[model samples]
Target: MAQPTAAESWSGGNEPMKAEYGKLMMWFFLVSDALTFTGFLTAYGFMRFGHEATWPIAEDVFTHFPGIEGDQPLLYVAFMTFVLIMSSVTMVIAVNAGHQLKKTAVAWWMIATIVGGFIFVGSQAWEWYHFIIGDKGGIELADGRVLKVAEAQTGEVLSLSQLVDGEAGHASNHLEKFSTGEVKTAFEANEGLVLQSPGKGHAQLTRTESLRLMQNAQVVQGANMKHNEYGQGQFANFFFFITGFHGFHVFSGVIFNIIIFYNVLLGTYERRKSYLMVEKVGLYWHFVDLVWVFVFTFFYLV
Candidate 1:
């Protein structure tokens, strides 16, 4: 056995290992991860493709804003989209700081990333709550026409003409007195909606109860014909599953960022003299951001 010369031991001196070790490993990991994500995305596409007709139009389904009325289209989700993109920008900055060996800067930028993650998660929770507890209840009729239950105490869900004509039925005279502002905000149309239980231990309505409501023809699904209360079944299913999956990712990202923050404070990277740990974490954070970009496009944009 003989000791190799310095030059022979050097990577460039012998048969090249192809790419630099760190970069090669990163690329390999990225390729595998890309495939994993592709599996999820492809699955989503297959499900959506088969049920296109039964999927709600994204804009019509999610356009709930204060002071908006009658199914007017809105772009609030575009704002959220921008916020998530900007968070990606901040994460990139943190990655660059690690390259420059700026530990304090890395700590601060990592904290910002966590804050952005928190904001995004909070927004998602708000969206979920709004969707689950929408003001109107949806009833699927035997003939398949949906009946919408409004906040009106009067049992009658009357048309504007019927209300003025005094022909609205028993629950019709309750006079909820919702102004345009209130109605627009309180009664978001087409979102996945569930009826609130009357009180504790009250049995929640099943499909049977919902069908019964529709059988009586008590209420038109929407007075203004703005939107049917029953969102396309496929849309509601995808909406919950996709957003819930992304939220889980965001939660995990926050936890990961916290660990990195502690590492930064303790000067671990400085002792190691390489910020590869930060780079690795950055890759993970960017992957999260990338997943959200697709989610926004599929769930909110299209």
Candidate 2:
């Protein structure tokens, strides 16, 4: 009973447990996924910079709109971006409500997030359809070059319908050799559409150049996995890969959100005395939204 023992530090409990085990694991997964995305974007950057010339113009390539006529420029993508951003905000509200143990608020915010995700996914699918269908069809030349039929003065690209007297569907194979009166007649009929060629970073053409190039050429239309009407095969390849990957992420996030939404509705979090799952999923949703912004800026806007 001599000297009183000095009190030791309280090291019995885990002090650094701000998040639960599942939530912490989710964070680790997200970090790894982010690295994967960074790698893909890096590869795309290398390809884009390496093949500076003949790269397709994003604006000219993605000019289609929904339920509206005429070229809407980047209107659709802009709307998608807005929707995704709003979803991120809703996720924030959801996580905040979860922190406060408010089941009703969390459910509503999660539903809003789910709705936004559905709209985004649907829009992307529609965009993919139009991309596959293509806008104004063009031909790929024998020399691995693309020739677009565009307005002589305005430099506006023309659809196959406009060029071939309202021919709706795609006409002629890319490899089929065709050079004679048909092209000449097309030239005569559509005086406005000149043979346009792609430049270093943009699609450029002149009436004189087009008139000369159309002399010996084959006819083709649209784009595919192997070919692109705009220019360079890489554009289509990258477009499909990156967008499809992001779409998959969105679809997965939507599924997770639906599960969480139902759980909230059923009072699962309340019974468990914790709503941390919502917060964890919200982290994932926020990460997805951030990735989309980077993709939009680099691939579309830039």
Candidate 3:
């Protein structure tokens, strides 16, 4: 048989899975990002389980709620998760509206999704603030163990400032200014306070032993790369790395949504006789929401 001409033999590349080029690229990006998140969560799981005896309890660590008098474990985190999930719902509606070529409906739904995104991002910021500032402070011993002050009888954790004479401001970094002598003085004056290690089965030390441990201890308030008032430093490190990374992705998605929303308002898709752009962005928004569900499970529920 005679060889076919090059032009006759040529055919456009296949559109695998019947996806448009842009949608396919987005899926590839999401898969890569998902792997990155999986690696991070896996590392966190190893560290937490390896030091199961000393790992901080999620409920105890995330007990703060805005404008609340006392600890409310995981309540605020649940709120954030709900908002993100609802945003995904709005994105679905927006995509459906685009499929029907209803420009006004698409615009309104896009706005709703954008609002939900803003709420979630703002809530995450509030959570980060509390995590970095800490609630009750602790003492880091020479061997890197952290011990919190609590009522000897009730075991209710107390802030270092509560034992001290003056009002301590809410500044997250203020505890760094307190001298060891000042901390020792506060500990001595509070007769009912004892040092307790954080963990599932950790024991509290007697007053005498706590005082002795204080002699070689450094005060730690809030969390940083080097010190954590909660428990092991690795917990804080992982918290910051994983959550901050996810937050960045959410922020980027919000910006992308905003651009799509503006285009929808301008009838750009209607003029093109296709709403493929809205569908593409919807895929991303849904992916972001799905990832948050896993994050919520790993960080809060697990």
Candidate 4:
């Protein structure tokens, strides 16, 4: 057999690694997207480690569950991670079915994958809702430190309404904000409540020190780009940006899966005698799932 001429090689007759153009392009896109996520997670790691002492603990911040009361740290997030991973598993099955030309199996597995994507996205939205709403209100000092009101004996963080005597009027941001005078007055009246530092160690102050700190503090409830009740403002900022970005990717993958699913039902691939489109979307889905593993580890587990 004669080797191909240089002209033939240059004319795109040679395929690198025996991959088709579409598969290679999908790989390229995934590589670029992986880099983008790496950059964001790297920035997050630097900031988090730089302020490790004062940074919010993932468990403490994500303690809420849908129907359960009290703190269930890491449980709900674990569920979300499990669902996403299962979706990736279903994608694998769908791809395998496509390879075998089993149309019915492919369609069913794709539906399962789509449902899993929807569940994960919905769960993330719920998580974000709780994060923005915040668990307990706190006071932000002039130096940007947050001091939470907690029971002196139990160390349980308390909301502003819990510290105040009566109904705290709702503010525009859905969190009740009180004037400095009102907060001071309420603090002076409560002997059991103490101001606690937002560190991992959660340092607390005596009654005298708490009162002095309350004098110049401002009430902060919930989280936004500028303020966070949990801890540092940057924590909230990164949470919103990184998670929202990932969620958007998942949402886009779902849309892609739906389009491909419809095509499968219409026998588009059957007529062509190829299920390459299903395999392509499966690659994207797996990439999204793999990225989430890293995000989950860095943001929640670690």
Candidate lDDT scores, in order, read 0.58, 0.78, 0.85, 0.86
Worst 10 residues of 1 by lDDT: 194-203
Q: Which stretches of candidate 1 lie over 4 Å from their true place?
A: 1-37, 65-74, 135-137, 143-229
Check candidate 2 and list the clashing pairs: none
- In model 4, the Cα lDDT at residue 296 comes to 94
User: Top model by TM-score, which number?
Assistant: 4
- lDDT, model 4, position 273: 84
Of the candidates shown, which would achieve the greatest lDDT relative to the real structure? 4
Q: What is the lDDT for 155 in model 1?
A: 34
- Ranked by lDDT, the better of candidates 1 and 3 is 3
Clashing pairs in 3: none
Candidates 1 and 4, the one with greater TM-score = 4
Worst 10 residues of 2 by lDDT: 169-178
In model 3, the runs with Cα more than 4 Å from the true position are: 1-10, 165-178, 189-192
Choose 2 or 4, whichever is better by lDDT.
Answer: 4
Give me candidate 3's TM-score against the actual structure: 0.89
Q: After superposition, how far is residue 145 of candidate 1 from its true place, in Å?
A: 7.1
